[model samples]
Target: MEETNLYYKLGGQKAIRAVVEEFYRRMLEDELVNEAFRGIDMDRLRNHQTAFLSYALGGPVEYDGRTLREGHKGLNITSEQYERMIRIMNDTLRTFNVADEDRVKIEAFLRSVKPFVVGQ
Candidate 1:
């Protein structure tokens, strides 16, 4: 059997965009990660996040956004904040009815990249 890409498993561009929107909504409503989004351009953030997740999830789309390290530079993000965001993302995925196997893969991918996005 061949491995499947999450982007397609996630129902392509439409579903990915919905996931991004829901993820941001969850993040902003949750106190743990809400502060990180203050004064940020949410529309642009959603676009970049959609593209990045699409790319990370093995979609055909390419992310044109800044590297995670460059984007997170000077944020002084903490591991706790990062984990919190992951939790919110998982919740969003669950809400979208993503299968456990796929969600695990997505979470793993996000965690693998955490070092690049966290801390000074």
Candidate 2:
């Protein structure tokens, strides 16, 4: 039997966009997380995030953006901030009613990218 990727399991691009929007909203609302986004272009970031997440979730889209480390470089993101971001992402997934198994997979993906995102 063929395995269904998380992209389709979570409904696809539209669904991913919704999750990204909600995730950003929550992030911006949080003072600590919001600082990282200061001076950044939110609209562009949102678009890139949507595409990145779609690709990460196994959608057919290609993400040609900067590597995670490069993108987050000089941000000085701390471990506490990273953990908060993870919590926010997980909460966003839960808000969208994503399956537990799928959330676990996504969490793993996030953890895998931590080295590239934090303390850059």
| Candidate that scores best on TM-score | 2
Regions of model 2 farther than 4 Å from truth: 1-3
RMSD from true fold, candidate 1: 1.9
Model 1 gets an lDDT of: 0.88
Q: How close is candidate 2 to the true structure, as a TM-score?
A: 0.96
The per-residue C-alpha lDDT of model 1 at residue 94 equals: 96
Evaluate model 2: give its lDDT.
0.92
Clashing pairs in 1: none
Q: Rate the local accuracy (lDDT) of all candidates.
A: 0.88, 0.92
Residue pairs with backbone overlap in model 2: none
| Model 2: per-residue Cα lDDT over 1-120, one tens digit each | 114999899888999999999999999999888999999999999999999998888889988999999999999999889999999999999999999999999999999999999999
How far residue 71's Cα lies from its native spot in candidate 2, in Å, is 0.3
Best by lDDT: 2
